[model samples]
Target: MIKTKRLLLRRVRKEDWKAIQRIWKDETVSPYAQYDNIKELDDLSVTNRIARWGREAEYYNHIFFAVCLQDEIIGYISCNRCVDAYEIGYCFHSKYHGQGYAKESVLGVIAYLLIKIQMEKIFILMVEYLNYSLDGRGKCMKIEHVAMYVNDMEKARDFFVKYLDGKSNDGYHNVKTDFRSYFISFDDGARLEIMNKPDMADDEKALNRTGLIHIAFSVGSKERVDELTHSLSADGFEVVSGPRTTGDGYYESCIIAIEGNQIEITI
Candidate 1:
């Protein structure tokens, strides 16, 4: 059982359904929560699915948690085991509007994962259609940029610096090259490099899929891997599969999310 000053998080018990239904029924909650407006609010189907889903998660170490205010249930948070990391999801009740509850709740869960469970990496699967014009930006989760391949070096260089890199017409690379390149980096040290070279094509294959495929988290080692797996389960992160070793000599796992992205855990 996890408790905030005004909220409690635990596995959904039989009695939680009533509060769950009530929370979902709030008119102010449905838009952001993505409920159907025309339908009479009934989460019997959802609760039923979640209950079974939680059970199935045990085999893979996946877990689910419900947020309650004293006895009134408000929302839920979920984390799933993926190839060496935790993937997160959250939602809340409509009645608790205008409070920083959602942000608080998410941060709380993440802190629990990083500090308590000792998870090194976390992935949040964001799909385009599933996006909410959130804050008017791309809402791509603090992404610096998504760079694709380009051809024709000299011409592309001028175009890139002129438009993307915020550069002027006069620019020169440290070394002259006929190949084109793109760089995407996070505020943190995370970075991705793409260059138009024959050998580089294979390297890009790891990340550049035409469609949304998978998001992964990197962990320290196999021991840390199992520790995180068990720790996340204790905190209610669902594990879909593994602590299994992949062909590359790394241990990995997976979990599913609402917007249809796979959370891959690997070391």
Candidate 2:
């Protein structure tokens, strides 16, 4: 249970389903539902959903909480761990809107996650597909994908595919813009978006360039780092840095690709 100055956040109970249903049925709150249009749900449908939420204690290994004030349920909060961060969402009864209850309830839940649950970082994707900006959320940044221009899309694709074990998408092409690209996805949901134009020149990136310096891939172990360094070097890839501990205590090695792009393989 999470308690604030004016709110109590707790697990939803069978009895709270009625209030939850009312909150979901509100047009104001229903707009925030990502998976379904809860405004159209009848009492039976709401009851079943609430029952499912109650039965699924972990909520698919995440969490859902009820926000209460003065012993009356007023809102709900749910979170899911996506990739390297957590996505959080909250909704309240129309009557409770603009009372700071939503923010307070969200803060309480965040505290529970960071302090009690010991999460390293928390990120908020949203409750709905529509975008709504938050004030001073401090978690506005989450890298969706890293994009780069590659001189040789095929070689760049092959490098990531062979070394990082990346899975290639079907790739994209735009004849009008003369743009071609490929998306390489890693196991941990990180993606590299490499694009190219036919007339683009192959230039060596200098160390002092004022842009993205390098991209890093985590291999999970020092042994794997050494092995990959040797194997990549043998395959004629440029080995820039060491398979030794760095100043920041990372067991890593840096390699230069055929496109002259730097990549750091780390543990």
By lDDT, who's the top model here?
2
Per-model root-mean-square deviation over C-alphas: 16.1, 11.0
Task: Kindly list the per-residue Cα lDDT of model 1 for residues 1-267, writing each as its tens digit.
Answer: 566767777766554656656665663345555422222244655465445444532333455678776766678777877756889876677667568776667777777778877889988754334365444664434544344443444444443333222222232244555454645332123433334643443233323357756546554345546766676556455677788987655577764421223446565
- lDDT value, residue 255 of candidate 2: 91
Instruction: Give the alpha carbon lDDT tens digit for every residue of 59-97 in model 2.
Output: 423477899888788889877654445678777877887
- TM-score of each prediction: 0.43, 0.49
Stretches of model 1 off by over 4 angstroms after superposition: 24-29, 35-44, 54-60, 125-245, 248-267
The runs of at least 3 residues in candidate 2 whose Cα sits more than 4 Å from the true structure, single-residue gaps closed, are 1-140
Q: Against the true structure, candidate 1 has what lDDT? A: 0.55
Report how far off residue 140 is in candidate 1 (Å): 16
